[model samples]
Structures are given as structure tokens and as C-alpha cells.
Target: MRKISVQNLKGGTGKSTTVVNLGAALALKGKRVLLIDTDSQAHVGMHLGIKHSVTLFDLMTIDLSIEEAIINARENLDCIVSDKKVAVLETMLVQMPRREEILRLRARRLKNLKYDYVLVDCSPSISLMHQNALLFADYLLIPVSMDVLSLAGASSIMDSSRMLLQMYEMPLQIMGVLPTIYDGRLNMSKEVVSILETNYKKLTSVLTPIRTDVKLKEAAAAHQTIFEYDPKSRGAEDYMRLADELLELETRLDRQKQKPAEATLTA
Candidate 1:
């Protein structure tokens, strides 16, 4: 499965929103998607209008198995929920051996599960769970809102990811940096996006921007994805575009991986 973590160091950058809608979009395309909410707020389940007594907290604490914590939120989409109860894990994790690899070990069990995609929604703060998320993820999908503060936060996230790669030698690829809450009419929005595209090209792919849309907020409040809430809305349009971009990227990577094998066989 393609493992991706949708994350940002700053809250309110639409990180959770992107995770829910993007997972929905991928599932709509006929792919089996698993969303793991690492945030203590447990917003992923809430966003999808799903509630389960067992959650990721239980899985991490060995109180439940992966299959037990999985919540089928929609057709082709499953979720591992989280809540404030996850905060207690930090203390316990510290005392565990190879704590940083706990999530990674749990993730290995998923290889037999046959999911097309596994998307993790991480918390905004720096925590033990955050490190574990980075270690478990094969790719990082960063959402940068159109503001200076958010932009700075995105840079910090990138820097931290780089440090983690150097320290752990995991070589986690940065899938892309998504521009969220964009408004073309606003000068600040335009400036922030311009800076990201022009200056940060080497860091990662700059994805199509998600425009500012009230329907996005309404969708979350109503417990539906943008597509389910308002398919005709700009919010839906943006996420579909994102889904398309991600699919294309995956295809490209697959082809690249195949080329080496093909050459080895031919040679």
C-alpha cells in the first residue's frame, strides 16, 4: 500500500480536512483507502461522522488489534480513530523498547491487508506520536495555508522531516506541498503561493491549490466530505484535482520502479 501522512505543524491549515476529503476522493475512484488519525482530537472519525469505542489508542496500547480498531467509514474506506485518550500513550511509549518503531511495527502487519492507500492524519504539535508518524510514513503530504505564519510552519515541517531522514536514514519522500485556503483576489494569498512555487521547487512537488470555500467548513460540520456534501462546490473540485495529481504521481513512480526491474531482466 502507498503510505502517506497528511500533516502540517500549524493547526487550522486544513490538514484534517485534506485527509478526509482526499481519502474520500480516492475511494470514489475505486481504491480501498485506510485513514489513521494520530491526532488526539480524533477529528478524522468526527469529520466522517463515525464513532467507535475502540480506536487507535487501543491498538497502540495493545488493548485491541488492527482489525478490531478499523472502522468502515464508507465504501472502500476504513478508518482507525483516535481521541484525547491517545495522549496517555506518550508516557507509556517512552518506557517501551524501540518506541520510535512502534507504529512502524504495527504498520508491517498491514502488508497482508491489501489496502491501496493508507493515509495518516498527524497532530500539529511536536510529540512522540509525530515522530512515530514520520517514521511509519513513506511519503509526507504537507498542506500550507495561504499566510506567512502558516508558510513558516510548513518550512519548519520540511526542515524537521529532513532532519529525521538524516537521523534515521529512512529516506521518506515528500510527496507534495498543497496550497490550501487560497484566494486569488487576495494579494497575500497570491504572494505566499508564488513564494512556495518559485522558491521551494527542490523541496517537493507544489500541488494545485485548494481555494477558499465556505462549503468546506460546512461539510466538516455536517459530517460529510466535500464530494458528499456538495459535489459541485469548489472544495470538491480542488480535492478531485488533488486526487488526480496524486494518482498521476503514483503511476509515474510505479513506472520508474518497473524500469529498473525491466532493465535487469533484459540485461
Candidate 2:
């Protein structure tokens, strides 16, 4: 029962794309998954072919549990949707205290659900909505494009992320920086990758670049996932590899927990 947020301070870093495909990929591995779209654009629900006008506004500001807002995308894929109207939550809940805890409260019910993962898509801008996303997250997965603005954006976001965690006293771990839409053949791309590794030494292999594949845009336009559109495509392969890395991390965490319990028994 872990919550993961995919966020970036700047736009066009493929944060939403990584979160969406990763959810689908994990489900393909038989993990029952939920994707919470905290973005105002609300493209995630559309990607799953859902036209329901009901959105996160209904769940966040009004009366609705996480389960009540969840829409079934497939046998294993579920989504808690949002829409442009979600931007109204700030004004809607401005008078209330603990407004940022909206996501945390809703997600608490998921503790008992038989879910393997909950992947959250955070809005690009820094808003209370993004705060909700962070408050509920166990870890943050930041997607940084190999571009000047996107790289610098990570530092700005680290400041904001730190502030939010400090407010809540959260001990959130950075899953890693995910580099997307990169073309290694270009000198700029290679140079940026080198700078990224040098600047962000904590980045895991999960930080490897995902090539700028045409299939990604095409699939997004069609409201389909890379796996559904072209499983053999480089973009699809990259996402699958990312998913595998996440699975390995989950396994490692489980072992880390068991080790303390084993040590206690030996003592």
C-alpha cells in the first residue's frame, strides 16, 4: 500500500505520459492499480475512454471516498478522475482547515483494498492540488526532460517539495529522476545527460533516458497507451523497463522490512 506521485515543476517533461503508461504496464503484470489524476487538464480519464463528467471536484471538495470516484478502465486498471473544473477546489475549500489532507484521507481507505499500486499524476503547476498529491505520496518520481528549463525546473521543484514535506513532517523518499523524450544522437541530449548524472548523483538507473519516439505522440493523440498502439515501439519498451525497475524497488522495500523482523527474532 504505497502511493507514488509523478511530478515536475515545468511542463512538457512527459510526467503524465510516464505515470499513465506505468500504471497500464503494472496492471498488465496482474497488479490491480489505480491512477489518480490531480491535473486540471484531466487527460488521464480520456485516455482510458471515459467520458464521465464526474470528476475529482466531486470527490475532493464534496462527499466521495476514493473508491466512490474510481472509474474502471479495464479488468485491472482503475482511475480517480479530474477535470478542468477541479481548479475550483482551492476556492471551494479555502475556508476549511486540512484541505491539503483531502487526498490523504481518501487514500487511507485504500489501505485495505487489494491493490498493488496507486500511481498519481500531479499537475504541472504548484497548487494546493499538488499538495494533496504530495501529502498522499510515499515517494516522489520526478520526470525531467533533457532540456535546459526542465533540468533547472527540478531544482525549483525540490525547494517546493521540501517545503511541503516539512509542513507535514513527511519522510518522503525520491524514487528517482526519470529522463524522457531524449535523443542520444544529438550533442545537446548527450551533453544534458552527462550534466544530469553529474548534478544528480542520487539518480538511479531508473533515470536512464527514454528515446523521443514518434509512437508516443501518436498514441497520446489516439487516447491509447503505447502498449496498445505499438508494443514493439521503443517508447513502449522503455516504459516496460521502467515498470520493471519499480517492481524491483517494491521487492527491495519488502525485503528491507523483513530484515528487521528477522533480526528481532534472532535477538
Candidate 1 TM-score, C-alpha based:
0.93
lDDT of 1 by residue, 1-267 (tens): 899988789888989999999999999999999999999988999999999898877888784457888889999999999998998989989998888778888767788889999999999977789888888887889899998888888877777876766687545467888999999999998999899998666555789999999999999999999999999999999999999999988875566445633311110
Candidates in order have lDDT scores of: 0.86, 0.79
**Cα shift from native, residue 40, model 1 (Å):** 0.6
Runs of candidate 2 with Cα error greater than 4 angstroms are: 203-206, 252-267
Residue 230 of model 2: what lDDT?
Answer: 94
Q: What is the model-wide C-alpha lDDT for candidate 2?
A: 0.79
Clashing residue pairs found in predicted model 1:
none
lDDT for position 92 in model 1? 89
Q: Report the error of model 2 at residue 65, Å.
A: 2.8
Q: Evaluated with TM-score, which candidate comes out highest?
A: 1
